[model samples]
Target chain A: NSKVIQTPRYLVKGQGQKAKMRCIPEKGHPVVFWYQQNKNNEFKFLINFQNQEVLQQIDMTEKRFSAECPSNSPCSLEIQSSEAGDSALYLCASSLSRHAETLYFGSGTRLTVL
Target chain B: GDSVTQTEGLVTLTEGLPVMLNCTYQSTYSPFLFWYVQHLNEAPKLLLKSFTDNKRPEHQGFHATLHKSSSSFHLQKSSAQLSDSALYYCALRYTGANTGKLTFGHGTILRVHP
Candidate 1:
């Protein structure tokens, strides 16, 4: 079965602390995406990478959050400083390509900022 | 700016009844629409996708048709099942040359009762 794997299903961090979430894309997939889902179930796009190149990223991701998909390594999204508003479920998804593809998502990492 | 809009926040239906989830999008460039369903404690799974060819995409029992003129890809099912209870997300992929990010709408929660 095609599945995306995410590490640290849950994470807790104090305000101003840094937190990192990891994701392993499905085999043979080339695109990885990161999204943040708030309590209201509103999904906010963070960033997406095609192979090893950064394709597109939202302002929030480029400013406070950083994500990278290195060769043979799990994709990582790191928050430089945790804030109350940053507490949400971070989801990672992988697709065969940018277009004409279905994305396979991993069980999101729920982050809590104290 | 690209955005996805879902009409309903919650819909409760009896099993065997038909289900419809409305989705709309706004984008300057042509958009690729998609539907994703997430069960409790599980990651979101791709349900269907819309292409510019104007053909309806169907998977399992769910289907959606892309209307580029209206910018809608509403999901519909002939018969709702108890297993259909989940959070459904409507998404649109940006087709701009520089952006390949997906914009997701606030999800709709479906509750199918027996």
Candidate 2:
């Protein structure tokens, strides 16, 4: 089975707290992507990484969120100051390449800010 | 700017009925369309994808045809099973970029009743 592993399936944080989620892509995948799904089930693209380099990122993701895919480590998305609006499901996906490829997604980390 | 549009938010059908989920896209580049299916509490998996060869892609009884003229790649099934009840997303890949990011539509939830 093609599976992506995400840590902390559910997370709860205070308004000013920090939240971090990690994803281990499938065995041989080379690209990783982060997306946020809101309560309305609308998915917003956050950022993507090829190896350890940031390929593309949305404005909102660059401002409040930071992601890193260190060598041999799982990819991580961290929020410095979590807000109520940041409460959503954060999904991590991976693909073999950047073009004309299929993505395999993780179960996702559901974040709730109090 | 690139975006995908899924017309049906929810579709309820009896078992063994044909299913069609509408998908439309707007992009400046030669878009590569895809269909992903998400089961309950699971990650989204690739169902089918469209290339530039004007060939329709099909998998596990689901099919999608890309129409460059209409900018649509609607997902259809001859007969949907109860296991087919899930959320479906239509996605597009950016042409010029080397990033593996995908712009996705809102989503359509299919509920197959017995």
Candidate 3:
């Protein structure tokens, strides 16, 4: 069974609605990362968190998108206002170390914006 | 910004044929390279990674050699199987960073026909 777990395998939200996805990292893994995979299979890095602390993120993660990895809780990525461009597969990954040499990923949450 | 380049969009082959996927990157600092495979309806999984120059990294039936001079880590396999058909992504991360986030390339779809 996959160690990394993501809830709500699929989500459908209309434009301007809120969309939230949650993830649980692998046991003992401290670094968690979120990536967006588009229909063309292009992967985009969204955010990284090191045990509840923001490590690095891209421009798309700001203002509209909010992500948090709280201690003893599942990490979540939320979109305040969904757009058609935001419809994609959201993947969560965790690494044994902060170096990101090897990562374990979840099945991902497929989000669709209409 | 660090970036990975993969020219191939799709590759079609028959079973037992050899497979080679091109991967190259540009980075300002020492970089770590990786290959990820995503099966149908499955999450992207790490297949291999390389940090040491000229050293090859192999997982399952796939292998890649890191060539620093050419900045390439092309994946290769002796023979392809129908099960091997999947989407492959090449990624890179800075080896000397506190925030080691991956920059991914446009994925290549490998279709192995029986």
Candidate 4:
């Protein structure tokens, strides 16, 4: 069992609808990361934050995804307009720090777009 | 850009047989190698990581050695177990500008039968 927590084990949304998922990083962890696992089991890095500051993100995430990790609130990743290609397993992981090599991942939220 | 390549998409084996999964990588800088295992409907968990000192990393009877010259970190186990069936991903973290980002390869599914 991982210490990281993700909400809504499954989510379904229609095209052009909004979809959101939440994740709570492990206690004492200051760095958080989000990844997408497609049907082919290929992993794509979306974004990462260190103590509420965005460290790096992909161009696709910048254009289509909204993500934030605020203090005293669970981190969130929301898609303004869900698309069929966006359907995937959203995984949230956390580490001790920006330089930590090991990441503790949560059970992902499976999103389906129709 | 950093990328990992897993040559085999699937490997089927009988229980008690030796296990080996090939993994190679390309990176501009010397990166940290990691292996993550995901069981059915479960979160991915770290299996092994490469040591900077060139020592082999092992866990649960699995081991991998990072070879900088070959840019490879092949996973191996002397004997396969039924419970070891899962999706295995090879990833690399660039220790350069973006330390939080991880580049992952298409996962290799391991099927161990009795």
Candidate 5:
């Protein structure tokens, strides 16, 4: 059965507004990842975390975009100011370890910025 | 930095026809290769993963072999099915890097016509 869950299956935001998406990783999974899929079907790695610490994030994500996986709380990715270019499918995935022999993904949150 | 290249942007095949999707990678270190399939409006799911100890990985009648010399892990199937129609992405995780992020290819859309 699928374990990863993402809230707000679809989101619509206006330009300059904040867009936030949440994810719940599978139980006992310590590693979580986020990616963005664009219209061209390209998957771009956004950020990843191990436990409660941020591991690696891309340059584009270092600014404007803030993400955290707090202990006992759901992981989240937030866009400070939504842009039409930010409109895409945000995917959340979880793995048992950072090595990630396997990864389970949620249905994803499709964000539309107008 | 690790990178993956999926030669085909799209493939159209008839049911029961042989299928092969080319995937090649570039990494300084021995990389962990993976194949993920995404149905429309769905999150990508792991289809096959390369284990260092295993020569070939197979799932759901799909299989791939990791060749270190070629830096390739091409996904192949004996026959294509209509259900197999989806977007396939090839990804790689560099063990040499401390990050758990996976670099993905542009993805290939497979259309199996009945």
Candidate 6:
């Protein structure tokens, strides 16, 4: 029922391995966001973008995470080195505008780090 | 800093019972509140959103009113259904901010048993 599409519904990786996930935001949506949901179900904001420009990102994301929403390309979030702590669901959401009240989310990529 | 608080981590109810999920928030600027529901292995979809004109938003038998004076937006349903079991999150983003960064609550898990 959601237009936002996320790829690789599941990912398995070893520690220090790179884990990359992609998301295609809903059609005509320009604002994209990435959030990490842990086993405890705590939602941690990772990064967000307005069109092709980065808007805001947490410090942890600035260090070990690489995310971008490029024109004509699906938005992606890649972990440089996966850790056990990084084993969680990575959710991508998009909205029609930067101030839009409603957000559409993807099924999310569940990463399992060994 | 903006934060959303969901008082209950889990709520168990029998089918046909009324459902209520409490949510509160603290924000620096004027914000819009929202409720999102995620079924098992599914993407989170917008259940309801607060209106600026004191309008109560509702979808799929669920409703929530934005009480700006109390800084609260609680989800409520007249009766619970078996299909209503899911994770519910309360989120908010400041209207004045150019960035659409949503501060989400830890989420409340609803279990409806027949």
**Please, what are the lDDT tens digits per residue for candidate 4 over residues A24-110?**
999999989999999999998999999899999989899989999999999999999999999999999999866636899999999
Clashing pairs in 5: none
lDDT of 2 by residue, A1-114 (tens): 548999999999999899999999988887999999899888998999999999999998888899999989999999999999999999999988898688889999999999
Name the lDDT of candidate 4: 0.93
Question: DockQ of each model against the real complex?
Answer: 0.63, 0.73, 0.74, 0.67, 0.66, 0.81
Where is model 1 chain A poorest over a 10-residue stretch in terms of lDDT?
A95-104
Ten-residue stretch with the least lDDT total in model 3 chain A: A95-104
lDDT of 2 at A35: 94
lDDT of 5: 0.91
Better of 1 and 5 by DockQ: 5
Model 4, B90: alpha-carbon shift in Å? 0.8
Model 4 chain A scores worst on lDDT over the 10 consecutive residues at A95-104
> Which stretches of model 3 miss by more than 4 angstroms?
B51-53
lDDT of candidate 5 over A3-108, digit per residue (tens): 8999889999999999999999999999999999888989998999999999999898998899999999999999999999999999999987777457789989
Tens-place lDDT per residue, model 3, B1-114, is 689999899999999999999999998887889999999999888899895656678889899998889999899999999999999999987656577688899999999999
Better of 2 and 6 by TM-score: 6
**What's the residue-level lDDT of B68 in candidate 6?**
82
Q: Which docking category, incorrect, acceptable, medium or high, applies to candidate 2?
A: medium
What lDDT score is found at residue B107 in candidate 3?
Answer: 90
Q: Tens digit of lDDT per residue, candidate 3, span A1-114?
A: 568999889999999999999999999999999999999999988999999889999898987999999999999999999999999999999987677568889999999999
**Model 4 chain B weakest lDDT span, ten residues long:** B94-103
Q: Write the per-residue lDDT of candidate 6 for residues B1-114, one digit (tens) a residue.
A: 789999999999999999999999998888989898999989988889888899888899999988888989999999999999999999998777678888999999999999
Docking class of 4: medium
DockQ of 4: 0.67
A1-114, model 1: which lDDT tens digit per residue? 338999899999999999999999999999999989898988888999998899888798889998999999999999999999999999999987776477888998999999
Native contacts, share recovered per candidate: 0.65, 0.79, 0.71, 0.58, 0.62, 0.83
Backbone clash total for model 3 is 0
Q: What residue runs in model 1 are displaced by over 4 Å at the alpha carbon?
A: B94-96
